[model samples]
Target: MSTKKISIGSKPTAKPVQPSADEWVEHRGNGNGPEPMKRLTIDIPESLHRTIKAQCAMRGTKIADEVRELLLQKYVKS
Candidate 1:
């Protein structure tokens, strides 16, 4: 005979928690620069996004391509 325990009202979940803006900025600069950004809906500042778009245009590439290239150069290479 064997006895096992497996009773719970609700199993614990490991949902990710969001950080405050200040924490986010600091955390992003911690050599890793925030985890890979998801390709979902986001509310980036218009000015920042516009600047990125301009850079993409100057580089003759799409915004996503520019971002990917920058990430590889800045993060992966390091």
Candidate 2:
């Protein structure tokens, strides 16, 4: 579902060359001021998510933002 180029028999096959940033934005939202970040609805087991939600609430942030922050800090900080 994501872009990763591949070579095919002495030729490169790129996935419909990416549009420029502004063009991508315009195309995605159909000229309606760009769409918000795509939201995903997942079904995680409550047992695991309960602790996750509690920590997010304690830190006063959305679960997505909190998770992103924690992951970036933990994984990308090295």
Best by TM-score: 2
Report how far off residue 14 is in candidate 1 (Å).
43
Candidate 1 regions exceeding 4 Å error are 1-43
- Write out the backbone clash pairs for model 2: none
Q: Model 2 Cα displacement at 36 (Å)?
A: 4.7
Encode model 2's per-residue lDDT on 1-78: one tens digit a residue.
Answer: 899998667666666876899988677766568546656577989988998989878988899987667767988956
TM-score for each candidate, following the candidate numbering: 0.38, 0.40
> Could you tell me which 10 consecutive residues in candidate 2 have the lowest summed lDDT?
31-40
